[model samples]
Target: MAKTKKLAFICYPGQETFIEPIVREYEKRPQYQVHRYYTDQQADVIAAVKWADILWLEWANQLTAVATQVYEIKSKSVIVRLHSYEALSSLPTRVNWKVVDYLVFVAPHIRDIVKMQIHDIEKQVCTKIIPNGLDIDNIPKNKVFNMYDIAYVCNLSLKKEPAMMLQIMAELVKFNPAFHLHSAGGWQDKGCEIYMKHMAKEMGIEENITYYGFVENMETFWPGKGILLSTSFHEGHPCNIMEGMARGLRPVIHNFIGAKGLYQEKYLFNTVVDAINMITEWSATTPDEKDYRKYVIDRGWTKKSMMASISKLIRLCGKKA
Candidate 1:
C-alpha cells in the first residue's frame, strides 16, 4: 500500500462551507488522512499541526495568524487560502507569510488587494488564483421557467449593497408587476437588515419580495428561481451566483470592481437601469439553461477541478517539505 500523508485543515467555526468539499475529497483518497480543526483552541490546533505533514489554513483571518505565528510548523508545509473579506481586514498583515509555502486567492483582484497591503508578498510566498468551486453535478438544473422570479442569494451586509437590489426590483415591477425577488441567506449586518426592510416597504417592493432566511436546501429553493441577481459593491468570485448558474438560472451580476475580469459583460450590469433592461431582455427571450451551466464548466469552477488544482499544489509542496 502507498504510504498515507497526513493533512490538517484549520478554520473558524461555521466557516467550513468552502473547505468541507475539499476535506471530503481528501478523506475518500486512500493516500491521505485528513484532520479538520474548525475551532480556535490552541492546544488542539497545535496538536493537529504537529500530527500532519501539511497544514491548510482555510481563511487568512485571526486563526491563520495564530497558527502561522506560534505553531511549531518549520518542518511542515503550510498553505493559506485567502477569501475576499480577509484581504480587506488587518489580519493578513498579522500572518507570517514567510512560513506559508503556498497562498491561494479566490480572485486576482483579491490577491492584488492583499499585495498592495503586504508589499513583499510576492517574494515571500507563492500565490495562485483559484476561483471558488461549485458541486455542479449535484445542483440539479430543475429550473422552473419564470423569468420574472429573480433570485438574490447573499447575506444581507453593507458591501452587498442591498438597496440596489430593491431599486432593480422597483424598476422591474414597473415593467411587470409579476416580477418578484426571492432573497436567501441570513442577515449578517443588523443595520443593513433594518434599513433594507424599512426601505423595501418605503419603495413599495415589500409585496414583490420574499425573504427565505438562511436556506439550508438550495437545491429545492433554486429550481423555481429564474434569474440570479448580485448587486454587490465588490466580491471574491461569489459561490452563490455560480450555484444559481449551475441550477440553470441566468446570472445578472453587477459590474462591480474586477467584475469584468471574472465574468463576461453579458451577465454584468453597471446601473439599475442596466439591470432592469437585462432582466427584461432575458424575460422576452428563450431561457438558455445550458449556456449558464456551460460557463461554469468552461471556467473550471467545479469541485473536481478545484480539488485537482489543490492536490497538484499539495504534491509540489510535499516534495519541497
Candidate 2:
C-alpha cells in the first residue's frame, strides 16, 4: 500500500479563490491526500478532522469551536493561516492555540502584531511568514489598453480603502486629465457599496472611476493597466498586488506590512496626499515595460517559493506514513 498523508483544510464558504489553488497544488504531490471542509458545516468539519493527519485552518475566528471538536477527536499537526484583517479584528476571540502546532502569517508584520496580542501563547504556537505567490506560467503578458489608465482590483471593502484610490485619482486628474481608474471586484457587505459610492461622489472623481464589478479573468484584467494602486490598511500578502506585479503593472501602494520590503522606498507613502504625489511623479517618468516586468519577476513569489515553504512546514511536522 502507498503511504498517504491525509490533510484537511477548514475555510470559510465562498473563498474558493484562496483555497482552491492551494488544494490543487498539494493534490499534485503523490504523498498527499487533501480534503476541504467548510466552517459553515460543523458536522462535516468534525468528521474531516477525525480522519485527517494534518488540519490546515484559514481563519483564526473559526478556530475556537473547531479546535474544541478537533481536540475531542485528538487531531494532530494543525496549521492556522492568519491574514492582515484578522490580526486587527480577531484578537479578542477565544482562540485555543494548543490545538494548533503552527501559525502561518502572510506577512511578518501580521505575525508581529499577533505575537503582541497573544503573548502568553508564544510557547504553544510556532509562527512562519510566507508571502502569497503567483503562478508565473498562467499570468498573461500585456493585454494592451489605452495609456494613462490606472487599475485598482480589490474587493470594495472598508479595509481595502478604495476611497483612498479615488482621492489619489482626483489629484492625478489635475495634472493628467487622461488618467482613468478601473476597478474590478465585488462588495461583500452593504456598507462597502455605500461607503464606495459616497467616497466617489465626495471626491468628484466618480466619472473617472469605472466599476467593472467581479472579474473572472484576472490575466486579462491585470495586464490592461499602466499602474496598480493598493491603499489597504492591512493585508496578508495581498493576491491582487502579487497578480498586478506578475502582469507587469507598476504598483503605487501605501506602506502596508506585506508590501513594505517589496517595493522601492519612493513607493512607500504615509498619507494619501504623499501617495498621489509619488505616483504622479513616477507615472511621468515611467520605466521601460521590460525593465518593470523583470523587476516584478525577480522578487520571490513564484510557485517554487510557495511550494518550498509549504514542503518545509510539512517536513517539520514530521510527515507520517
Best by lDDT: 1
Would you list the C-alpha lDDT of every candidate in the order shown?
0.87, 0.73
Candidate 1 lDDT for residue 254: 92
Best by TM-score: 1
Model 2: clashing residue pairs? none
Clash totals in order:
0, 0
Q: Which stretches of candidate 1 lie over 4 Å from their true place?
A: none
Q: Where is model 2 more than 4 Å wrong at Cα?
A: 63-65, 72-75, 91-93, 143-147, 290-292, 318-321
The residue-by-residue lDDT of candidate 2 on 1-321, one tens digit each, is: 767788778777875466678888888877888887765777777787788888777767654346545554344887777766677776424667766777887777777777677765567677787777778787765756344788888888878877677778888887787788888888866887887788778877778888888988765576658787888877777777777766667777888765666677665687978877777776766535565556656776776787789778876664532
Task: For candidate 1, give the lDDT of residue 114.
Answer: 88
Model 1 lDDT tens row, 1-321:
656788889988899999988898889888778898999788777887789888999999988888887647877899999999998888899988888999999999998888788988888899998888887777778546688888999988989998999988988898899999999989999888898899989988899999999998876677777899999998998998888887888899999878888788999998899999999999977578888888899999998888889989988877765
Candidate 1 least-lDDT 10 residues: 136-145
Q: Evaluate model 1: give its lDDT.
A: 0.87
